[model samples]
Structure formats: structure tokens, C-alpha cells
Target: MKEGNGLQIPAGMRDLLPGVACDQRQLESRCTGLFTSWGYQEVITPTLEYLDAITIDTGEEIRDHLFQLFDRQGKILALRPEMTTPIARVVATRLRGAALPLRLCYAANVFRYEEPQAGRQREIAQAGVEMIGAATPLADAEVIALAVEAIKQSGLEDFQISLGQIEIFNGLMEELPLTVEQKSKVRTLVAKKDFVSLEELLNSYGITGAPADRILQLPTLHGGAEVLEQAAWLGVNDRARQGLENLRQVYQALASFGVSDFVALDLGVLRGFDYYTGIVFEGYTVGLGFPICGGGRYDNLLGQLGYPCPATGFALGLDRILLALARTNPPARATSAVYLIGGDDTAAMLNKATQLRSQGLSVEIDVLGRDEASLQAYAQTRGITQVQYCRQGG
Candidate 1:
């Protein structure tokens, strides 16, 4: 039997109480409204998925962070670590022939067995959109535009989306005279932004000349349009060079949407090769070490799942955005319903509540026949603007 820990909840899990819980709901509602306006229909996926499916494309790195259990038949199961893979599976198997360029959005909870921190919840709330079947620069730019708008609409003043293309790194690596294993090690170092160790590692490999120099410089080639221009001149293969060209077009497309101010180039924002194939970006704000939002182009994922399609998407850490908003733009307090005070007229108060509710107002009828003055005081405390007294025989 499970041990009783009544008020003591498990690590990394939390309860969203009255005020903040309401704020979260309001935020989600607002996002849903925004998504609807953008023509992205919402969809809900299962919270539980098979363990093998989750770990397949993502590699074994995620296995340690998964919360797994065995089913009655001994089949392995796990809570969703993320949404993209599950959604990809849905597109592949269930909605195989659905319309192309499906714009699907979701507001849901995902679980990961991670260390609890300020914004890292074991059970996290995420709101995101998947733009599948379109592989053009416009598709990439569209999601970035939506992400920028969502943050701006969320009342966050100071935040930026760091944009980068994975192919640039992959391209530079391909030009190097290193084996696959050696390139993987170098990529890992650059991903962590470990310039010192990366330099030493390059030296250990006896790599000299342009490829080494350009590889070292790739991580630091960030910020503004200069980076893209610099990319055009970087010493790399044609494939990586073509990746930069693609990112340049994306940047130009973003400018047309008038969101260039919210974007910056950071080739260092390496997300990983397992999923994100092309342009990867991260949303960051001052004083927050983690990105509030992240997503990228995955032209290969659907193919891996048996469907051949190009797609781009993003996922916002709703809890992390809430935390940031709390620190900066604190949400408004929740309101209360009209309180009905009863004095031996509970039935009358019920009738009054029904009348008010029918008129599209919230109402709370008294059950214990609380006094008028006391009920009024309670209403005032709960932010209820209106109150009615139902007296007996009146």
C-alpha cells in the first residue's frame, strides 16, 4: 500500500491554489483565444504512451528522465516527456490522410522525472502549435511570429527569441577531417558553450587551419544581421552554407512580420540532432536562465515515423512563463460571485441565484442563512461586487 503523506506532496509536483491557479487558467484561456484567431485548431493527446515509442527517436538520453511503470500485461508504459513525438505518432497512424499543413495546437500537462527547481516542474503545463506538412521558410517564420505575439500578449516586456540553424554546425563539422565519434564530441562541447574545453579538444585532435577556426567561431557568431552575413563568408561545406541561406530567408520573412526586434541570431543554440532538423530557436528574458519557449523545424521526424512531411513547431513552458510574469507582470486577482445572504429564506435565495445566473452573472447562495452584515463582509473580502439579502416572509 502507498504511504499516506496527506499535506506532503511528492517532490517536483505542486498544487496551483486559488489566486495563481486562476491566473494560469486565464492565461491558457487567453492563449486558446489567440490560437483560435490564428486558425490553429486545438487537439488533446493521451497523457500516457508506451516507453519504447517515447525513447525511440529521442535516443537513450531521455530514458533516465522518464517516469515508467509496467502495465497489467507487463507492457512498459510512461508518462509523456514531451508532446511532439506523440503528436507525430498521431499524424502518422491516426490522421494519416488528414489535410496537409495541419495547424494543431495543444494546452496540456507533460511529466518528466527531473530535478525540481524554480521553474522546472515535474508535471509541467505547455501550450504550443505544430505546423506540419509545410517546409518553406514561411512555415518557420510563421511559428516564430506566433511565439513572439504570444509572449508580447502575455504582458512580458523584455524577452528575445534566440534563433539558430543546426545545419550550420552540422555543416562545419562535416567539413572537418574528424570521424563521426570525434564530430559528436565536438558538437556536444559546442552545445554546452564550453569554448575552453572545445579549444583544448580541437588541439588534442591536431586540427589546424580554417575548419578548426570556423568551428570555434560558430558558437560566438551570434547577435543581429551581422551574424547571417558572417555566415555567408564562413568556411564550411555547401550544405551548411545552404542552411545559412535558408536561415537568412527566414530572418527576412520575420522582418516582414515586424517581429525582427524580438529575434536575434545565436548559432550556439544547438538543440540536438534527434528531432529538430533545421532552424531552432529559444525564448529568453532577463533574469531567467531558462527559455520560456522553444521549438524548431523537423523535416525528418515525420519520415522517421512512416509519414513523409516537413514541419515546424514550438512549445512554451507555461509554468515558466507564469513564473516570469509573476516576477514582472503579476496577474490580476480572481473575482468572486455575487453572495446571497439568507435569513430563514434559503429557498428564496436559491431563486434569486437562479435569476442572476440566468442573466449571465455568477451567484453564490447562502446555505447556513448567514447574517446580512457578515455575508456582505465576506463578499467584500472575496472581491464580490454585489450582494442581496433574502429575508423571511418578505
Candidate 2:
């Protein structure tokens, strides 16, 4: 290969060097332990999927973020932009006959075509779990509680889980005879926290007084348990009323689990993902610009994949979480690894390296023709703390 001028990696893509990779592995291992303790089984899915297989109404937002290519059969394929859709496909097809209340976990790298920013990237790693076949309020509470515990176990203490019910907006839309276009506009406004636009849209429809007040209050309906009571006092229509009741039930269940301290209700939290059908929530760190973790109930998603099982899951942005933790605590010193240097004693060095690995130590042997000083420099640069010199018949 010939070197070219200004040849460089793409903007949003990044390479994780040895030290950073180790840090990521540690974080992932810790998360896996937490999920396993909660009785979730691990599952692996493919990185590529036929565009049609993962398609959904809310998929338009995701499509713009996907890295798409043409397959050998002239079919469009996309690098997975998220794990939930693929997991839903798996549940709908492969595990369609699995037992009820199936719990699954996964760790994967997802690709997205988006501009990179601090703590954001085109390729990101995530660790997540899905709880399927359980639709009770207690089930929802259990997942949220588990999420809180996972964050705590990840060494992140200053974080909050913002909860929202998609039903609130869905309920309000059900009462008004609005076109799909209007509903979409409302959804967009709500997601962007555009209160002025929301007010204009509501007022333009001839809604005023109590009805208008309640509609505008949608964006601000967030806080603690008190927010739920205020939401109820706003004269919820039949659909909104039902949604509110469901939310109250979820909150009470969470309280019973002793995890209400880390939760807050946010009625205006309309995540950009369209697949979310019910209660939606995201975990946020104060210093980060985006959620470190997100997931929600998608009871209808599996149905789209041919299975009708209800499911809810959450995914932690492993890379972003690591970046945030790095900013706060700095990455711990890389563990010392053993480096074996040899020449004519290559066989001996290799044997010793294998033995060290068997004992659970990272061991690397020099196979190149570099001299001892060069080998020592290489080991030092890689944060290798020990170097063992191996000579034949000595």
C-alpha cells in the first residue's frame, strides 16, 4: 500500500489504543457481573441486518444515522445503529417459543453516521439487557431499579434517571381530532422543549383556558412524586387519565422497591427514537450533553417482527460512560503486563509466556529483531511493568 497525502481516518470514527481498550473491557466486565446477578442471560446478535428486517415507523430518525451499503444481492443493508431493534427481531424470530419472562443481556459495538462531539462518536460500544414477556407495573419498576443499581455499580454516583410516559402525549392526541402531520409536529415540539411553538400550535387549534393551560403544561410536567399529582390535577382526558394512572402505578411499584430516590418524572421527555411505545426513560450525568443510558417499554415492537411478546430494555453507552468517568476520576493506571525478550531462546520465551498466560497474566514475547533497549522502550511505552530476559541453556 502506498501512503497518500492527508490520508486519515474518518472524523467520527476513533481507534481505541491498548490502554483504552483495557479500560473498556473492565467496564464491560463489571456491567456483565451486575446483569448476571440479576438473572439476565447473555445473547449475541449480528452487526449487519437487511434494512427491511429492522425497519419501523420510528426508524426514519434512525435511518439518517445508519451506515448503509448495498449487499451482493443488491439489497440495502445497514450497520446496526442500536441493539434494541435487533434484539426485538431475535425475540420475534429465534426465541419466539422461549419461556415467558425471558431475560437477556448483550455487549456490542453499534455504528451510526453522525457528526462526532465530545463523548459522542460514530462507533460506540454498549452493554444492555432486555426483559421480555412481562408487562406488569412491577416488571417496569424492577427494570428501572436494576438500571439504578447498574449505574451505582459502574462507579457513577452523581446521576439521575429521568422517567416519562409516551402515553401522556399519545393520550392527548387521542382526544383531539388532529391529522398525523399535526401530531408529528406536536411530537417534534415536545421533544425539542419548544414551549412557544407548542403554545402556538395548541392556541391555533382554538384550544384555550383550562384546555390550553393543560396542554402547555405538558413540557413542564416533571419533578418528583408531586409531578404525578399535578399531572392528575390538569384534567387529563380519558386517554391521558389512563396514562397517568399507569404512571402512578409504576411509581408506587418503584417506591416499594426503594429506588424512587434516583428517579424523576418528565412528561415532556419525547426521545427521538420512534419505536418507543410506552414508558420511556434516560439516565443523565450533569456534565454530559447526552444521556449515558436509555431504553423504554416497546410492547408493540416485537409484534412488528412477527412475535407479539411485550418487552422493555435499556442500553448503557459504554464508551460515553467511560469518557464521563475518565473526566471525573481519570482512568486508573493500566495493570502491569509481562514482556519476555529473547533471541536464540525464542522457544523458551514462548513457553514461559504461555505459562504466564495460564496463570492469568497478560504476557507478550518479542518476535521482531529489535534490540534489548528497543524492547525495553516498547514495554515501557505500553505500561508494561516487568521484562524477563530468556536465554538458551542458561
Candidate 3:
């Protein structure tokens, strides 16, 4: 690649200009406020963490995405790829003896070294909560319901949360007679929704009939409560049955939370993270191809971090939420009026500007000493409404 003038940001990174940045903050504020109202207190963690600690339970796929650097002592430090691991680290070390069921929340930027796309970026902003120490279905339901509510509160009316349980797939895979590599391949195929490749591969391994059919039908199992009944016969093993039962319990709880209408049963849903032990889900809007939010019950993460505790949580992609809102509802033009004060008397203009600012108004003063016509033109160019002409005596 030819080196040009050094005016370019690295690939997979882009600047959020004034207008877009403001919208992003507003969206994040709405979601974080909602989390606080639900008794979840906010926590902040370092953007860089010990590389070994962060990837302790995240698996090789996530490990490959980390942005790594060496510290002064040659210790490897990495920009956090996700908040869950760091939060888990904190819970195990700092808040270990705080109490059971610690409700924590965070809104922070994480970095990942990956090929960026529409919704995916190298630097991602996430707002999420982790519910530590509760293993009940209600805890799982709380996070899901909160997720639905968070997205709704972000001005996104058209969205759905597809709920799934990792145990369901794990059980089914265990019942099958495939090797570890074969099972991994199946998981990848199912996650990609590549039924054709999955079937071809399964058949190539000489697996067919009911066994193959069940695996193929797994992804198709999606809908209302009735989908659970349809899956009854499929959960021939104890583990699979337990996962289905857990989903049923969580589903009922979601109804009580008044968010069942926004959720659907998607048995094929799979989370990429390896720590998720139970129910998992992803939130999707109408037009966007990627999920605006995702998370699940990682009952084992804290345990792996040396604290044996059950936990459930989620993270919403702030950038993707902004994208979804832009598609559905472009915000009404800045209704919060901005004023530009200009006049013969600098003191009067400054005083007026200060007064307006005190009242929570956005005010700008004409420091250039321009004429009324030029001041008005400047305001018009800058989209500053409500231009005022203050005078020494008027």
C-alpha cells in the first residue's frame, strides 16, 4: 500500500462526527438510566487488562480477536474485547464477599482486532449489566426483559429477542456419535444457518435418518409457547429436557414482566461465547442484519474466575442501536433551541448568553463583532436558531 499524507485513521476505525456522537451519547444515556432504575449500579473497568486473565474462559475464537500489547515488564496486556470477562474478574477479586446477587452495570468502549463491517467495528461501545450469584430462571428472565426494555427505551419499536439455551444444543450434541471436530463443524454450520452445508457434511459422515433429522430441525424450532411443545419429543436426554424446562420457566417469567410479546422461542439460537451455560439470546431490529444486543446466562464465568457464583447478563451495541434508530426513526430535528447572541454591547451579549446557558439552553456568542446581517448569516450557516441582538441600552 502506498503511504499518502498521514490524515487517515487505521482501517476498521472511524470518527463519529458531532451530530452522530451526540446521538450515540443520548442513546447510551437512555439505556444506562434504565439499567440504574432496575437496581443495577454502574461499574467501570480498565480498557486494558492482563491478556491471560481476560481470555481465561472466552475460548480461542475470542482470544484471536484481542488487541494485544506488552507492558513495561514484558507482561502481555490486551485491550478488552468484551466487558463480561473484566466484570467477572472484578466480581471474583474485588466484590467476592460483597453479597449474593450483585447487580452491576457498565457502559464502555472495548477494542477488538477484527475485520469491521456494517454493525461490527474495531472499537465498540457497549452498555450492559451483569447479575451475579443468582441461578434462578427469574434472573435470566430479568436480563432478557431488561434487554427488551433497554432497546425499546432507545427509541427502537421494531425489534425482537430470540431466546435460546446452550444446554439444549450441548445435550443434543452429546447424544450424537460424532467426534469433537465433527461436532464443532456442526455448531458452526448451525450458527451460520447453513442447512445445506450442514446436511451435506452430516451425510458425508454416514449419519442420516432420525438422528440427522433432529439436528436439521433444531434451527427451525422458533415461535411462541407452542414451539416448546413441538420440542418435547426432541429432548430425549435429561440435559436437553432440563434446558427446555428452563426456557419454559423463563418464558413464563417474561410474560409476568410484560415483555413476552417482544420475545420468541428460537431453539437454534447460539451464542459465540464459550462461557454461556444456560439460556442465551440476541436482540435484532427490523432492517439491520446484525443483533443490536446480545447476552445470556454465564453461570460458570465467575466460577472460572475463582469465585463459584451463578450469573446472567447482556451487552447492547450502542453503534448498532444508533444505526437501527436511523433506519426506523430519524430523530426529529434538534428541537432544543440554540441561541446566538450578538450586539453593540459585549457585556450585554455575554450576560444574555450566560442567562440562557443557566436555563439549560445552548447559547453561542458572536465574538467576531459582526453586523446584524453577518451575525444572522453565521447563525443560519451553523444551524443556530433564535439569534438575539442585545444592546447597551434597549
Candidate 4:
């Protein structure tokens, strides 16, 4: 007796039942506490925005990934694919006059139209922080430290923060004599980790020298601090050379914060987002394939929005972090419920349930007129370890 479509949820989306929902809420609460303690205030942005607002040069690859629709007013809108652009718009327009180094945090669901995978979903929850109006290296360092601490607070023990400088690639691009079409091809190859294609492309352009070799090495260049020294020998142009120096200064600033142990340098980490102007980083756990969190400095993005402020922040994928932590440390079992049975004592059960709820206890009553045996079976299936009996006399 079902409808035409049958009862089923859509693909790349899911319902979080009681057990998973409870665990997720606990994780969100823990993260909220951590953010509040760090003096970052929480803010909420609309889940949907004008399509053009969220899609500006977000990258050609991601444009098709957004879930778009037409509003009642005949305007194109999209469920936000990411939080950064909306937050940037907020800072640019509404909070433009707020103090420097504004720290704002949020936990919300973001939508994307994409093929579903084991742990990735089209609709996902993200908890992130944005610090606007600060362009100092110390601001970047603080964001990195905060990301590490949030992961640690989530019960993750083994993890690494891979750091990179966008300027590295920008520097190389500035020095390249290739045409725009060739530059696009190089960016695509670099992003895909297609070193063979990169070498082929370089050879096709008839470019040969230490600079080409160094640029070719970009994809494989990542490790500890010493890799920075090796990068220096790559024979970059003066602009690229200055960019390298900027990276060195940022790395030293991170070291001064005492978070050097958790950081790794990766000169090849040209994050996919086209907006990032400088430092970029992603957090990874050993068992996970994708980064649990990522962010970067976008000094020019605000200017695009008309305010022209420098900002940097990171977004923690709440669902992915929950999954990673669940693998490492499974969430504790939910508490037992107090079940009230029998329709005869409905009034008494209602009063008792309300009282228990006030006392911060999970309480349920049988309204289906089932027998005690059936009610017991239901409780067992729900993982209610204990049940309290309430009677009219008692």
C-alpha cells in the first residue's frame, strides 16, 4: 500500500537514526565548547544563496558539483557548496565594521551534487572558523594550531597537518613563458598528480633547464622541514624565490607557536580552490583517504566582495571527523530508557514521563496496547539496558 515511488531515501543522502544522531550531537557539542573556549563566536548563514555568489571562480571542476534550483521569484539559487564564500560575503557586507581579527565559527550542512562514496556524501555537515581582517603570519599559525587541537579534542591521537604555500605554484606560473592554454594544462596535471603528463607537457613546450626540473618535482615535493632546503636549489625566478622566503617565514612562525611537532611541509599542496592566495593546509588521519579538515589564506577574496580584507580559516568536516573518530574510538552506548506501559494508567504515565524528562532521563511509554512481553522485546531491540517500572500506586 505504498505510493508510486516506493519507500526509499534518495542517493548520496541519509537519515541519521537515534544512535548515530546522538553520537553526532555529542561530537558537535564537544567541538562547540572547544571553539568557544578559544574565543571564537558562533554565527549562522543561510543554507541557500544566489547561485552566482557561491560559484565565482570556485573552480571549473566544482561548478557542476553544486546543487542548484530556481526560487519562487525566478532567481537562480544554490545550496551552498562550501561555507567560505558565504562567510566572506557576510564579513564584507554586514560585519564590515567589526573589529580586526574577527573570529567566527559555524556548524552547518553543505550540499553538493556528486557521486556518493563510502564516507563522502553530497549533503554533509561542516564545522569551521573564519578569522577576518588579520594578515599576519601569526594568524595563520593560530588557525593551524586550532585545527590540531580540535582533532585532538575529538579523540584522534595519530594525525598530521600537511602545510603548503600556494605562492609556490603562483611563482612558477609567473615565471613560465607558456601560453594561457599551456598554463591551464599544467595546473590540471599538477592537481591530478600526473607527473608523466607534466613532463610530457614541459617537453612539448620545448622548455628545459633547472627551473623546469624543479617545477616538474613539485608534485612529489612534500615531507619534513628539510624539503624546504632542497626546494631552494630548484632555480626559481626572483618572484618565485620571494614566495619561498614567505613560506619560510610562515613555517618559522608556526614553530614559534610550539605546534611544530604536528606540522609537515609540502611544497606541492596547491589546494584545488582557486581563491587561495597564500598558505594552504589539510588535516589527515592514518586510516582516512581524504582530509578531515582543510583551509587556507584568501587575501584577495574579500576584495572581490568589495571590502578588500585579508582573512584565513579552516573548516572541519563534522561527519568525516565523526567517522574517523568512530573508527578509532567508538562512541559510548546511550543510556537506558524508563518505559511506562498500559493504557489504563495513561495519565499517571504522562506525569511520570514528564518528571523523568525534567530530570534529564530518557523515558518512553507504550501507546500501542502491546503486552509486557512485546514491550520488553521492543526495549531490548532499542538497546535500552535498563527499564524502570512505574505503577499507579507507586
What lDDT is reached at residue 314 by model 1?
91
* Best candidate according to lDDT: 3
Worst 10 residues of 4 by lDDT: 335-344
Query: What lDDT, from 0 to 1, does candidate 4 have?
Result: 0.82
Residue 276 lDDT in candidate 3: 88
Cα lDDT listed for each candidate: 0.85, 0.83, 0.89, 0.82
Question: What is the alpha-carbon lDDT for the whole of candidate 2?
Answer: 0.83
Tens digits of per-residue lDDT for model 4 on 201-294? Answer: 8899986786578778887877777878878865366666776777777789888878788888877677777788888899989789988999
- Candidate 3 residues lying further than 4 Å off, grouped into runs, are 1-5, 333-337
For candidate 2, lDDT tens digit of each residue in 1-394? 5586356788788888877888888889998889989999999999999888766645576878888899888999988888888888888888889999999999999998888898789999999899999998888888888888888878888899989888888877776777877777888888777999888987887767776676678888879989987888643576677778778889889899898889999888878777777778889986897999988888888887778888888999999888888888886666456555554587888888888898998777787856677877887887777887776785
Q: Give candidate 4 misplaced runs (Cα > 4 Å).
A: 1-6, 335-352, 366-377
Rank candidates, lDDT, best first.
Answer: 3, 1, 2, 4
Which candidate achieves the best TM-score against the true structure? 3
Candidate 3: 10-residue stretch with minimal lDDT = 328-337
Judged by lDDT against the true structure, how good is candidate 1? 0.85
Using lDDT as the measure, name the better of candidate 2 and candidate 3.
3
lDDT of 3 by residue, 252-342 (tens): 9999999999999998888888888999999988888888899999988888888989999999999999888888888754633488899
Give me candidate 2's TM-score against the actual structure.
Answer: 0.89
Q: Per TM-score, what order, best first? A: 3, 1, 4, 2
TM-score winner, 1 or 2: 1
